[model samples]
Target: MRTIAIGDIHGGLKGLVQLLNKLEVRDEDELIFMGDYVDGWSESAQVVQFLIELSQKIECVFIRGNHDVWCEEWLETGEVNMTWYIHGGMETMASYDDFSDEEKKEHLAFFRKLKLYHLDDQNRLFLHAGFTSMHGVEKEVHKPTLYFDRTLWELALAMDNNLDTKSYFYPNRLKHYHEIYIGHTPTTNFKCDIPMNAINIWNVDTGAAFKGRITGMDIETKTFLQSDPVYTLYPNEKGRNKD
Candidate 1:
C-alpha cells in the first residue's frame, strides 16, 4: 500500500495522465494531491472531472490551493477575480464552457470538500502551501495561511540539516510532524526539476504550471516518478509561462 504525494497539476491533465500511467497505481494505494488542479492549461475542467471520478475508485486526499480558492469563489458567486483572471483563471473558466451547471456545482462541491491539511496516522503532514504557526497546523490562527504562506518552506530551506530535534534551535513547527509534504512553491524555482527535500519537508511541485513536469513521490521510500515536461505535452499552450 504505497502512499504517494502528488504535486500541483495546474490544469495539465495530459501531464497528470502521463504521470499516473507511470505510477501504475493499486487499489490500496493512497494518493495525496497537493492541489492547484486548475488554472494553467486547457483542461482545467477535465482535470477536476477526472479527479472526481478517481476519488470514487481510490483513497484520495485533496488539499485546497490558492488558485482553487479563487475558482471556488467564482463557481459559487459567478464573480471573477481580476487577479485570478490574469494568472490563468480565464483558461479555467473557459474550460468549463462545455460543462453543465449541475456539473459545475458538483465540481464546486469537490473544491469545497478539499482539506486544508492532512495529518496521516504516521504523523506525516501534507498541505498545499504552508502554515505560520510555530506550534503546528492545529494551532494555525489564519486558515488561509495554510494555502498562501511560503515562510514554512523558506524556514525549512534555511534550517541547518544538522540541527538536532532535541536542541532549542529546531523549528517548533517541523518538530510536530515526522515528514512534511507541500507543493505551492515549485521545486523548479531552485532550478531542479524534481521533488526536493529540505530537512524533513518535501516539496513535490515541480512547476507543472510552466516548463517542469508533474511529480509523484512515495512517502516512505522517497522514490518518485514524473511526466514529460508539461509544456511539451501542450505545445500550443504557453501555460503560466506567459505570465
Candidate 2:
C-alpha cells in the first residue's frame, strides 16, 4: 500500500481536493494528514467534512496542529485569543457559519480527538509542529505539540541560518525516527530538509493560505505534488471573512 503524508492544509479545502485528485488515492492506500486542517482559508467546515468522508474510504490519520488546538480551545470556551485568531483561527470560525450548533459540536469533538503526534510502527513520526523536547518527553509536557516549551524551534532556526549548534538530539533518549514530517513554520523555499543521524526531518508548510502552493508528499516514493497558486484572505480585508 502506498503511504502518503500531506502537510498542513490550513483550511485550503479546494487545494486539498485538487491535490487529492491529482494523487488519485485508492482504497488500500494510507493517507496521513499532518494537521492544521482548519483555519487560514475559507472552507474549514468543508475541509472537515471532506476528511470525514475520506476517512470512510481509506486509512487516514489526523494529527493536531497549533491552529487546530486553538480552534478546539476557542470552540470549547468561546475565549478567542488574538495570537491564534490573527494567525488563522478567524477563517476557521467563519467556516462554521452554515453549520448548526450540533454540527459545530461534532466538529469540535473531532478536533479534540486529534492526536498531537503520530508514530507509525516503522518509526516514521508525523506532527504538525516539531518536538520541542525529545519525542518521548513531548507527551509529558503540557501542551507539548502546540506550545513552545523547549528550544527546538530556536535551535532549528539557528541551524537553518548556518549558525553553530550543539548536540542534535535532546536528552530524552528518543532516537530520531526514520523521518519526521512537520508543518507550522513557513519556509520561503517551500520545503526544508534537515538530516539528524539516520533520520531526515521535512518541513512542508508552503504557506498555501498566504497565496502560496499546497504541498503533498508521497512518503513511500519520496516525491511531492503541489497545487496551483490561489488568493488568500488578507488581514483586515473587509468582507474577506464571509463564509
Candidate 3:
C-alpha cells in the first residue's frame, strides 16, 4: 500500500482539489494529511466538507494543526479570539457561516477528533508542525509541540548526518524516527517551494497559505504532486494576509 503525505492546505479547497486530482489516490493507499486545513484562503468550510467525504473513501490519518484547533474552539463554543481572527481566522469564520448546524457539528467533530501526529508502519513520523525532543520519538509527544514547534526542524537541518551519528546528541529534538515529516514551517520560507528533505527530515508545507502551491508527496518515491499557485486560485481575496 502506498503512503502519501500531504502538506498544509490552509483552506485552499481549489488547490487541494487540484492536488488530489494529481495524486489519483488508490483505495488501499494510506493518506497522511499534515493539516492547517483552514484559516488562510477563502474556502475553509468547503475544505472541511471535502475532507469529510475524503475520509470515508480513503484510509486517512488526519493530524491536527493549530489553525484547526482554533477553529474548533470557535465552532464548539462560538468564542472568537481576536488574535485568531487577525491571522486568517476571519476567512474561516466567513466560510463556516454558510454551513448548516448539522454540517457544522460534523465538521467540528472531525476537527476535535484530529490527532496531533501519526506514526506509520515504516516508523516514519508525520505531524503538522514539530515535536518535543525531551523523550524519544517512540514516546508520546505533547500536543502543543506537535503542532507548534519549529526547533525540531531546525535541529534536523543543522545536524551533520541525521543526528544518529552525532557525537554530542541533544535529546531535545529530532532525527529519532526513521523519517520525520512536518508542515508548520512553510518550505516557501526556506525558498524551496516544494517538499524538501534535509538530512532525513521532510518539510512538506510548501506555503499553500501564501503564494506557493499545495503539495502531496508519495512518501516512498518522494514524488510530489502539486496544485497551481494558491494565490491565483483565489484571485479576488487575500490569502493569509500575513502569509
Candidate 4:
C-alpha cells in the first residue's frame, strides 16, 4: 500500500478533488494531509465537509495549521481575528454561511481533533509547519512552534548538502527523523510550483491559496501529482492573490 502526502489545500476544493481523482486512491493507501485545508477560495466549508466524509472511507491523517487554529477560534468564539480575516479567514467564514449552527459545531469538532504532528513507523515526521525542538517534536515546549516555526525549513535550506549526518555539526532536529514533510510555506515562494526537497525535508505546499496547484506525493517514491492551478478553477475570484 502506498502512502501519499498531500500539501496545503487552502479551501481549493476543486483542486483537491482533481488531485485526488488523479491519484486514483485505493482503500489500502494511506493519505496524509499537511494541512491548511481551509481559508482561501470560496469553498472552505465544502472542503471541510468533503474531508470529513473522505476520512471515513480512507485512512487519513490531518495536521493542523496556523490558519486552521484561527478558524477554530472563530468558529467556537464568534470573534474574528483581524490578521486571519485579512489573510483569507473572511472567505472561510463566508463559506459557512449556508451551514446550520449544528453543522458549524461539527466542523468545529473536526478542527479541534486535528493533530499537531504525526510520526510514522518509519521515523518520518509530518507537520503543517515546523517544530523547534532539537531533540524532536515530542520534546517541543511551545505548542505553536509545531505549526508556526519557519526556522526548521530555513535551516534545512541553508545547510550544506555535503554535511555528514554523523558529524557533530549536523542539526539534532534533522537527525531525529529519516525524512520530514511540511506544507505551510509554499514552494511557490521560491519560484517552484512542485514539491521541493531541501536535504531530507520535503515542502509540499505549492501555493494553492494563490495561483498554484494542490500537490500530492508518494512518500516512498517521491513521485507526485499536481492539479491545474487553483485560481484557474475559480477564475471569477482572486483567492488570496489580491494586491
Write down the lDDT of every candidate, Cα atoms only: 0.95, 0.68, 0.85, 0.95
lDDT of 2: 0.68
Per-residue lDDT over 1-243 for candidate 3, one digit per residue giving the tens place of the 0 to 100 score: 888899999999999989888888889988899989999899999999999999999899999999988999999999998888988899999997778999999999999889878886778888888766557544645657778888878877776663454556644445366888899998888888988787778998998998898999889999888999899999998887553
RMSD of 3: 1.9
Per-residue error at 108 for model 4, in Å? 0.6
lDDT of 2 by residue, 1-243 (tens): 888877767777878888888988889989888777877777878888888888878899988877787888888898998888777777778888898888878888888789877889988877776665454534546665442322443454444333222446433322466666777665534343221111256666666656465777888777878766434333343212334
Where model 2 places Cα greater than 4 Å from the true spot, the runs are 134-140, 146-174, 189-199, 232-243
- Identify the runs in model 1 with alpha carbons over 4 angstroms from their true place: none
- Candidate 4 lDDT over 1-243, as tens digits, reads 999999999999999999999999999999999989989999999999999999999999999999999999999999999999999999999999999999999999999999999999999999999988888999999999989999999999999989999999999989999999999999999999999998899999999999899999999999999999999999999889998
Q: How displaced is residue 199 in candidate 3, in Å? A: 1.8
In candidate 2, where is summed lDDT lowest over 10 consecutive residues?
Answer: 190-199
My TM-score estimates for the predictions, one after another, are 0.99, 0.80, 0.93, 0.99
Angstrom error at residue 124, model 3: 0.7
Q: Which 10 consecutive positions of candidate 4 have the poorest summed lDDT?
A: 128-137
Error of 3 at 90 (Å): 0.1
Collision pairs in model 2: none
| Residue-wise C-alpha lDDT for candidate 1, range 1-243, written one tens digit per residue | 999999999999999999999999999999999989999999999999999999999999999999999999999999999999989899999999999999999999999999999999989999999998889999999999999999999999998999999999887888899999999998899999999999899999999998899999999999999999999999899889985
**Candidate 1 clash total?**
0
